[model samples]
Structures are given as C-alpha cells and as structure tokens.
Target: MRIYEKVHLVVATPGRILDLIEKGVAKVNNCRVVCLDEADKLLGHDFKGMLDRLISNLPERRQILLYSATFPLTVEYFMKRHMKTPYEVNLMDELTLKGITQYYAFVQERQKVHCLNTLFTKLQINQSIIFCNSTQRVELLAKKITELGYSCYYIHAKMAQTHRNRVFHDFRAGLCRNLVCSDLFTRGIDIQAVNMAETYLHRIGRSGRFGHLGIAINLITYDDRFLLHRIEGELGTEIKPIPKVRIPNLCIRCRNNSIMSWTRWSLKASCIPDKRSLQLRLLI
Candidate 1:
C-alpha cells in the first residue's frame, strides 16, 4: 500500500476561505504562506474580523505578507496582532505614478456625459477603465458609454462574484475596449494594454501599470473641487489643464463661440469656476 499526503494551493476571498475552513473543507493548520493584497482594505472594519479568524487557524510558524499601495492606520492593528518584526518595502516616495499624465475637466453635472463623449473621441485610448463612485453610477455610465457606440462592460462589488470575474477576465483579454467599474476594481488589477483611465477616485493607478506609459483623465464637477485639491496635495504631484480645445459646431452654448479654452489653471491650487464656465485642469 502506498500513502500520499495531499497538498493544495488555494486563492480565495477571506470570507469564502473562512467559510470553507468552518465547514471543515479547508485545512489551514499546515498552511505555510498567507498573502493579503490591498492590506488596508482587508484590515478595515468590514473584513478585519474574518481575516483575524482566518489567520488564527494557520500555523504559528507560517509566513504572512501584506501588500498595498497605501497602508493606512487601519493596517497597524493587524500588523501588531499577527506579525513579528515585519519588514516593509515602499517603492514609492510619491503617491502618483510618474508614467501617468493626470488631467481634469471641469464640467457641470449634466455635461459630464457630454464631456466624456468628447474625450472618447479625442483621446487615443487602447483600453480604458472608467471608475464611478458607486455601483449605481457604474451601471449608468456603462450604459451611456455603450449608447455612445463604444464597446463597454461594467463591474462592481454588488455584482455576483462569478459575473464580476467573467467581466474582469473578458476585459483583460481584450474583449472590450472600455470597462466601467467602481472602487471594487481599484487595487491589484494589472492590464498592460490599458493606456488610459477615467476615475473620480485616486485609483488612476489602474493605468500606467507595471511601468507602462498611460494617462489618467478625471471629470471634475463643482462638488469635487475640494477633493481634487486634496488629492494633489496628498499625492505631491501637480494636475494641469489641457491646452485650448476648439469645439467646432458642438453647440456647447458658450459666449465665445464654441471655442472653449482652459485658463488660469494652477499647480498649487485648483481653480473651480462657477458652473457656467468650462475649464480644463491638468495635473502633472
């Protein structure tokens, strides 16, 4: 008779993995290595308990690794509890990526879709990821993009895991030119073909990934004025305005014909004019 010891490698969400452990389907007693991506989010209030429980089931001699672009205060608790003199390697001295050119267009809430349409026509996008603030917005924006005669797909945290995985896989495989998603896809998505990203959040990291050249375009409204400035200060980078854009026969209803110019943009501050004026802001 021959006896064999089975060894398994599993990659799963903390909740799913914990469920399998609870059901006696997964044995982590001999687990050698546990790696957590987006460590800040996992250590947040929502998943911290489950992650703690999962770690408790692993062997005491196991190696633990935490990885994230930003390590917030939330991760301190987990490190203190689980790690013994852990080492951290921070490759970024600044928050923003050097390979990414950041820009923002100030538009009214209603004109956002129109502005985005213009950008789609103007920018040379290979594969782009558009990020919305909420799941509802993700769906709505995806619909609008599709209506604009573009190939698009949408994903969010609220969607089924299987569906989201399929959408992500298809998008990465070049099945779609654009993907509309929420912050759910912000971290750990590496698509080299993505040369442009439109985001309201600081998730512009989606582009310029793996040391590739890319651009990040943000659609800013009056409400997002403070946020734009705060991000600049935090990232220690400048966002600048795009050069003059000549909107020919676009019927934007501006006083100076259809020609819209970006003026008085600042590196130290964001000049958010009233809703009536259209200005483009750029961050470099």
Candidate 2:
C-alpha cells in the first residue's frame, strides 16, 4: 500500500527490496539517490548477487553513496564497476579511536569465561557491549554472563528484525547494563553510556563515542595471536597487556592535562581504590 502510494523514501534490506521489485510492489527506477550504509558488508559474498540485481533495477542516472569505516579490495572493485568517478572523503589516518584505552589479556580457550568474569569484577563498567564473532557464541556467552549474575541480553543477525530493534532500543534506553551481540551491532550504533566494550578492532570502536572516555578489553586465546598481531598492524595501534590493578573512570582529557582536579591514572602504575566507574565522572 505504501509502495503503491509512491512513497519517496524506502529503507530495506537488499534481498527484501529485490523481492518487492520483482513482485512489482516497490519501484526504485525513479529513486534519485541510493545510499548504501555498511557497504563493505553489503557487497560481500552473501549479499553481493542480490545487491547487484537490486542495483540493476535502479535508474542508471541515480546518485549512489557508499559509506563504511573500511573498504576491502572487493568493495573497491565493486565501486569501480558500479560508479563512475566517485568522489571519496577519507577522514581517518588511523583505524583506532583516540579516547579508547585498548588492552589485551592472553588466556586459554577454556579459561575465556574465567577471564571475562575477572574483567567484570575488576573493571568499573557503566554499560558494556560484548561482541562475539559468531551467533552461537553470542548466545552462549550471554547465557554464561547471566549465570554469573550479570544482567545480559544477546542479539544476532539471525533474530527477527523486530526483536533485534527491541533489544537495541532497550539497551540504548538503559533497561539493561550489558549486551552481547554478533558483529551486526558493531556498525554505526552509538550508545553514549557504554564505557566498557569487548571485541576486535571494529567492535572496539563501539565505546568512546565522539571523544568520550572508554575502555576496550580483548580476551585473546592462543589461537588468536596471529589475528591480534594483524589487527595491531592494520590499526597501527598497540594493545597493551592489562595491568593487575583496576582502573576507575578514565578521563582522556585529564591525562592530557585538561583538568587539574582529575587525577591521572597510569596503566603502568598500580591503582588506588576509587569510587568512579568507567561511565561518567565529575571532575571536582
């Protein structure tokens, strides 16, 4: 009905939109602008064929925009084939965000749960998002976190979109303190109160929004050593080994001599007991 009403704007997944196009329900032939957010993933193996088919249905003269943090060779190739003389604005020289403190702990595969438990106990987290590489791991880790007595909710790409939206909204609204999700949640979603985050390179960016203080702790098993090195190399940032002491609220500005009252905490130095968690602190 909405399509028949000639709605000017339409947002949908490639597969669904393609189906609609084939069914003669949605018309993108007159779409003036086509924007693909997360273009890297959209152009990847899974959706590439559907996305190509969908684009084929669009008017050739339409403006197309591709946005993503990183563009792999495949995405670049796709852009070359689809776009003519596309102008790009690259804002990043380094991959990692400035306000995030990155730390890594080496643990055995079986000890990952224990390491996570240790992080939960030692770190001062206001709200946290933990990323698991797989959907199965996301569910399993969320269950383990719940069993450990921490409030947790999990989301994966396989879940219904409505259910995913509900979980995302509830988490953003502070209905829960912790969320476990697959890589689907790592892209472009901003939660200001999330001071603690766990995952790989892209996932770490979930914390420290717009120059705010945040911490990223990576629990790495032996199998992940090569991946860690590669990530460090690609990002051009070192992930220091976590210190034994617990750190309270970190003020990036404080460390950079922005405030006199906010005590500077060093990663190398032993920490004193403090009340401030990683969330927010009023420097007094």
Candidate 3:
C-alpha cells in the first residue's frame, strides 16, 4: 500500500484544514471551483483573516460559489473584498421564501415542548428537525419526546464522535420521524445572533430538499420575540403566527406517508395542480 494517498476532495474543521494548507500538504492551487457551503457563517469578520489567506493562495481565476440561507451585510462586505462580480440567488422575497413556508409560533417556555409535540401529531412533515440552543436542552427534549411515544432522536456536540455518526445516518435513512438538535448542529462555523437569521434558514433548508415541499417552524419564547422580529424584518418574509392547538392522537408517520401518497397520486392525474393548490389542500 502507498504510504501517501492522492486525494481529490478533503473536508475538515477550519484549524485542521488551515494546518494542512500551511504545511503544503493540502494543495488547491489547481482547484477549478472553491465552494463555501456555509458562506454567510464563515466569511464574516470572524473568519475574514483565515478566509482571505486561503483565497489568496488559491487559483486567481477559480470560480467561487457561496451558499448561505440568509444574505447579510457582512456577507456583502466579504464579497466586495474577495469575490468579483459574483452572482447571487435570493431564496426569500417580500412575501415568501422561493417555496419554503416559515412560521414563528410564540409558545411560552412552559408550553414550548408540548407545542412541538402537538405539531408532530398535526402536521404531515416528511423530515423535520427541531432546534434548541443548548446540548442539555437537546437531551431533555429528546427524553420528553420519547416519553410522549414519539419516534425521535437527537444530535449534539457532546455525543461521542462515533455515536454522532450513527445518529446522522439514522436520520438520513428516515429511521426517525424527528431530529432534535441544538444550534451546535453547525459547529466550527460561527452562527451567532448577528448571522442567526441565516442559520435558521440554513437548518430549515435541510428539509424540503430536491424541490420537494418543506416547512420551517421556529418555537421561540417571549424573550426571543425581539430576535424573531429582527430576523423577519431582515428577510422581508412573514413568519405567520400559528395559534396553539391541542395535541392530537394521530400516528405521525402514518399521516405523513398517507399525505405523500396522495400528493404523488395527484401529481400523476391528468390535470396537475399548481404548488399553491397542493399547499392549500394538505397544509403540508
């Protein structure tokens, strides 16, 4: 076996990746396209120095593609400094996201978990992820959900690396209906309040992939009302405040599956319905 293997793609944390680059062990001078998956989170002031150094070392004419959920002021500044005539694609407009529906439900801290549970029972969500702000909350929420007999799992930075891998795969395989996690879900890439609007958009973008219908629901308490309004104003999209409803006894998986089946059936019909029709019909 060769002691050194040739690599075409490399993924690692910032510090480690920077270490490799500094040592000339990870070469990207010939790279045709340099993509930053979480651009808004990474290109801000926090990573400006590292990012500028890395970009300075890359091919001068390489294509730079940045993907971020929310476009922010810092991101614009970063583009001005590093990117030339870069094109942009905005997912949000004055009225709505390109396709995603966002709801900012004001659930009091005491009823927050219950409200989440009620949503699971009511909505026909295919793949949903619930975000909390801390690891301890992730654990506590997961436990409470299981007690309610919901098929749910959680991932946080505190878990063993191996175990975290298993949980991620389980989620991708659709083994669980819900994934409860903390904002640490996007670790190493700083996602602070300044860029949290983008962070929320990024997380919700996880679901509703491949042009399928998706929903993003944020459960915030009174304290977070200011933050929620800030995000809404910045995005220029409405997060409809949904009234709290009683928890239903429906089987979430069965409801989700049935709804999906019906959607497929409808799509195959001679008169195909528009997106608005489907959304209104199923409230998916």
Candidate 4:
C-alpha cells in the first residue's frame, strides 16, 4: 500500500474521478502535478460541483495545468481561481501552416450532399471526414453517401462506446475512407492521411492538423453566417468566400419569375421620378 502512493493514476471521466475520491480509491491531498485535459469541457457548469469538490481536497501548493484547444469563459474563471500566477501560452498565432487551403461556399442546406458529391468527384479526395452538427444528421448523411456508391462510416455520441471504438479503429486502418461524424471526433481522433474535410460552422478545426497539406471545404448557409463570423473573430482569421461560378439553370422548378419580377419592377420605379407609378406599384 505504501509503494502504491508513488504510482501515477489516471481517471478518464469526471463522474469516475468523483466516485474514486469518495470511495477513497484516489487521494488528491498529496498530488503535486494535476493535469486537467479538455479543461474547457471539464469546467462546464455540469461538472462545476464535481470540480469544486475535487479542488477542495487537493493540496494548495500543487501545480495545476489546464489544457484545452478552445478555452471558454468558465474554464478561464477556473484557472483564475485555482492557478497561482500561471503564465498563459497562446500558440495559435504562431502555429502557421502553409499546407492547408481553406475555402468556404455559401450553399443551401438542401444542396449540401450534392455539392459534396460534386467536390469529391472533382477533387478525388481519397480520405476525408464530413462533420455535421448533430448525430441524426451524421447518420442520415452517411447513409445517403453510402447509397451513392461511396464507402462511408459514421460516429456520434449516441453510439455505444464499443461501437465508436470499432468505427475509429476501422477509420485508422483505412478500411473506411470517408468518415461522417459530429463534434465527437474533432479533438482527439488522429487520422494522419486525411486529404480533405467538409463541415459546417465550428467543426472546421478537425482538418489541416500537424501542418499536413489538407483542404477544408466549409458548406455554409446564410443562417450559419453569424456563427462563421464568431469563429473567425475567435481565430483572428477570416475565411474568404469562394466565388460562385454561374451555372445554367435547367430545372423547371426554378423558372418561377415572381420574385425577380417584383425586384426588377421595384428597382425601376424607385429610380423613376413618377410618384404615381410608384404609388400604384405599392398599392398592387
């Protein structure tokens, strides 16, 4: 029992950590180096009570290391309260990568899959991950892509841990070339040969890792512009919009000219000095 005190311990989950602490399986009183990985997630309000309980039991003079890819306000507060005059290291600005070419396209939600398919055919991306915002969408999109004669696998938080492990193993072994997932794979999953990535909003961070030459294609809609703007502000980098090439309209459904007619008439009357014509147009 005395020799066990010198061994390093690891507890993966907050609940498990608290349970160990309560059961006297782990002792925090003598801990000299405490590392909180994914500190932003660990410092969420959902884990606040557990963290407080853990901190209350730790030695006051111990060093606390908080590591996170994205720091939230709650995590910052936790550092201030717990850490003693720690120096901040921000490497994001210095971490430059020349290999990745990031591009964004303003696409409608309905056209996302079609646009992805077009990109796959044009670019011939051998390995990629398509990130979606939700688990249901991940499954739906994976099914759709697989049905289209592409091999795709999906992972999400809703899946059992064993299933997720199997999917990740298959992905790493190159048994599956395309992976469709939610934010679950954004941080820790390491697939070194990913040639391209497609995602919406905040999940774009999954690509271009370790200075590898990668292409990140963001399929954004007008509704996601605000989110994109916020992410740009956080990263201190603007994602330039891709210039859309005009495509010939072939669909009968797109032939409705009511909206265009209204716009053209409104603009013409607005430029004209005929107040009566404008009034008539407004009345109509």
Candidate 5:
C-alpha cells in the first residue's frame, strides 16, 4: 500500500473515501485542501449522507473549493450549510471558450452512422472522444468505427473497473486514436442541470483541455433541435451547420506549432432553427 502519510493528493468518490476514513486508512483532519469536484452531484440527495459525514470530519481551517460545471441551488444549499462567505465564479455565465469550436450535423437516423464514418475518413484526428447517451450505443458505435478501420475503443459504467482502467491508460498512452464513451468518462451529473444549455460546454470541454484547441461535433436529427437551441442560448455561441462550416478538418488548436492545416470537409444537411419551437426546458 502507498503510504498515506506521504500522500499529498487523494482522488476518490465520496462513499469510498468515507469508508477509507472510517477504517483509518485515510485521514483528513490535517488536510489543507478539500475540493469537491462536480460538487453539484456530490451535494445531491443521493450522496447527502456520505457527503455530510465526510465534510464533518474535514479540518476546520482548510481551503474548501467546490467546482461544478453548473451550479444548481442544491449546491447553494450545501454551501450555506457548510461554507463561509463562498465566492461564486460564474465564468461560463459570462464568457465562452475560444479554444474549442462546436458544430452539429443534422442527419437522418439512418444516415448518422455514415456521416460519422465520413468524418473519420476525412479528419486527421490527433485524438477525440465521441459521447453517446447509452452504453449500448457506445459499444455498437465502437464496433462500427473499428470495422471501418479507425483506431477506437470504448468505456461505459457497466464495464469492470479493471477493464475501464486499462482503457483509460491505453487512451492516455495514445494507443487509441478515438474513444467512444457513454458519458461515463465525462464529469457532471446525468440528471437535469439548472438548464441543459451548458451541457455542450461541459461535454465539449473534455477536448481542448489545458488551453489546447478542440472540436466537438454533435449528430442531431429532428429530435435534438430543441435541446440544441437551449445550448446555443446558454453559450450565446452559434453552432455552425456542417454544410456552411468553414473548416474542412478539426484542427483548431490555438497553440499550434506547425500542425495547423485546413481541409475541405463539407457535408450538406439542414438543421434550420425554428424560432417558434425554441423552447427551453428544465432550466431553473
């Protein structure tokens, strides 16, 4: 076992960390920093008991930072219960990331796969992650992409921890060119946020990390128009349609060192926003 005394950092889910603390395998009273990442989810009702127990044992004078993609009122409730004079940094509320470019492809349900395949064949991907809403789709998409000769792999909540660990390691090592995920690898809650508009901001954030450039493309049909509009309103940035998009490839890195090249990747499809149908939902 790694010596806990010498360990300066520990990353764990609340329930497991609470168990470790209860068994004296981990101690937090002397800890100087306690960060609740995706703290909105941590402070949710599902984790209320474990979170309460963990926070109760933390050192009183420590720096407690709560980070979340979107701060919901439940998080505010937890802050009132525990923190003193917490400062709110609503960065996303006021600004958009210039590092990443977002786009959407409107394809028929039957044509989505072909469009995705078309993307892979054209772009010179350094690495990219594709998210699906379901584990079954993650597996099926990974299979289809692999069969098309793209170097790809997948991860989801249902996979065993050991296998998931291996996949993560492989991805970081650059053994894989693309990853198909079910949002299991992404942070933030699967539940409703204050509004769903920032969903793309956080989801696309997985790319262009550490101040690098990234691109996010969503495959949407008629079913996703409303959700897409809400996302646009939230970011105040328009997601360009694939047909009228200026870039032929996904190389948007701002800190480029001669790896910047553009190609013509045009796919003609239509996703006209119907102003009358742009209804925002689940956004408080």
Candidate 6:
C-alpha cells in the first residue's frame, strides 16, 4: 500500500501497534481497512492477547484482510470471531514453487558445516543464508565459516535490534556473501536472488520466497528424518532425500591428542571417543 502511495499506511508489530492505537499514532475508530500478514504467527499464543486487545478496540465497521502462508486451527478461530461473511481464499491447494529445487542430504550435525562448505564450493553460490535453530550454533558456524575463508556474519533474536538491522543491511548490500541466522530471518526479511539456502528442519521455512529461483539444501540426519517427514506431511509435498556423501577427514589442531574415533551420522563426520557423548551433544 505504501508503494502504491496509499493514504495513511501504519505498519508495526502487534504489541507496538496496539500501543500506537492507544497513543494515537493510528486511530482504530477511523481505520477503514486492516491487513494482517502472517496472521497465523501473529495470532499465536504470544500475540493472541495483543490481537484480542486490538480487535476489541477496533471500530465495528471496517474491512479486515488476514493473510498467512500457513493456516492452522487457531487462525481459523480468530477469523471466525473477527470477520463477518469473510471470503475464504485457500491458496494452499494451489501454492507451488516452480523455480526452487529442494534437496535433502542425510548428514551428522558435526559435518553440517563441512557439507555446507563443500556445497558452497561446488555451486559457487553468490549469496546465501545458513539457518540454525539456536544463537550459539549460529555464532559457532559463522566463526568456523569465516575461519575457512568465507565472508560470513550471523544474527539472532538475542542481539540488540540495532545490531540485527546493521547485519541485515550489510547482507542485503552484498557486503557479506553468507549469513548464519536463527528463525528470525525465515519470515519477513527479503533478500533478492538468494542462490542457496543451507538449513536444518526448523529453518527449511526460509527458502524459495515469492517465486524466486533458489535451492534449499537441507543437511539432515537419521534422527532428523522423523521431523522432516512431519514437515513434508504438513506441506503436502515430498522432500526427496539426497544421497549422502562421506566427508573427508581434516587434521585436528587440539593439543590433547586422545585418539579420536570417527563416526558418520547425517552427512557429517565427528571424531568422538564415545557414542554417549555424541548422543548427549545431539540432544543439546
């Protein structure tokens, strides 16, 4: 709407939007139209109360449009409660990504970085985002990738808002070729021509945005197959498992040379003295 030079476009987070309405940044009484993008996420437990408050304050006569990529039962309830004779647009049946290639590689957690490095070298992807489930892993992967001579940066929800903005800005400007991030980058953030996306099950939601030509390469493990299956079931699509390739061993620089025995789990190789420790690490 702002791009079309529409009158009075106020975009904000659900909580802040409510605050603004109360403080007069926007007038709910005067609002002729209300649009909620990613309505399912916005209507989740975290923002449900805020949504309720906002809806309670909204004027009786107003058009509300709720848009979501994925709609579960909660979103449906919210719509039935707030919308009068709402038009149901079920795009899930028609939704398709023609330009994106989805491939899964069964590799271990430790070898994910190595597999990613191999893929990056093989594809020579100009720009990419590596999504991790946690901030600590993002930081560790970014550091390792940088040490391996790749220009990489990482951002997570725990970081200051200003820092996240700067990191995103730099990434968009092509100052960095690779980004390691949590689910924060999976939804709203848009970067053009992302040639590649390397992620796990949780982060698979980030790729193939807006019909762009992209490749989503997931490094999965035997343990991750169940989660991947659940995602495929939810999406009503087949996530093809790619043939796993053995990662060549690299010399360790650790001072303690306690003979490290190697094991392969997804496509990653780890040198561990015991399997119990590896299982514990994976659980963590």
Candidate with top TM-score is: 2
Candidate 3: stretches off by over 4 Å: 1-37, 44-70, 81-96, 124-127, 183-196, 244-284
What lDDT tens digits, residue by residue, belong to model 4 across residues 233-278?
6555666664455334312111122211112211233322221111
Across 1-284, the per-residue lDDT of candidate 3 in tens digits comes to 22156767666655566777789877778866777877777866567667777777788877878876556777777789878888878753321244555667666788877776666555444455667777898889889988998888898889998988888777767687667776656433221111126655555533333344545667777788888787777666677665444333322122133332332211233222232122210111
In model 2, the runs with Cα more than 4 Å from the true position are 1-37, 45-64, 77-84, 90-96, 196-201, 243-251, 254-276, 279-284
Writing each residue's lDDT as its tens digit, candidate 6 over 84-190 gives 88998776432333334466777887888788777655443557777777899989988998999989989999999999999999988979888888878756445
Order the candidate numbers by lDDT, best to worst: 2, 1, 5, 6, 4, 3
RMSD of 1: 10.1
User: Where's the lowest-lDDT run of ten residues in candidate 1?
Assistant: 264-273
Cα lDDT over the full model 4:
0.62
Q: Whose lDDT is greatest here? A: 2
Clashes of 3: 0
Candidate 5's C-alpha runs over 4 A off are: 1-37, 42-66, 72-85, 89-96, 188-198, 244-264, 267-284
For model 1, the stretches where C-alpha displacement exceeds 4 angstroms are: 1-39, 42-67, 72-86, 91-96, 196-202, 245-284
2 or 4, greater by TM-score? 2
- Per residue, candidate 5 scores C-alpha lDDT tens digits across 87-172 of 88875432234545566777797886787777655554456677777899889988987988888888899999999889888876
Looking at candidate 2, what is the lDDT of residue 43?
81
Error (Å) of candidate 3 at residue 35 is 8.4
Candidate with better TM-score, 5 vs 6 = 5
Q: Give per-residue CA lDDT, model 1, range 1-284, as digits (tens).
A: 11133556677889998998899878789898999986777776678599889988999898999987776556776888899999989974434465566777777778877877776655445567777778898899889989999999999999999999999889888898888888777665556566441132247654433444456767777687787787676556676654454423322223333432332221111221233222221221
- Models 1 onward score TM values of 0.59, 0.66, 0.58, 0.62, 0.60, 0.58
Residue 134 in model 3: shift from native, Å? 1.8
Between prediction 4 and prediction 5, the one with superior lDDT is 5
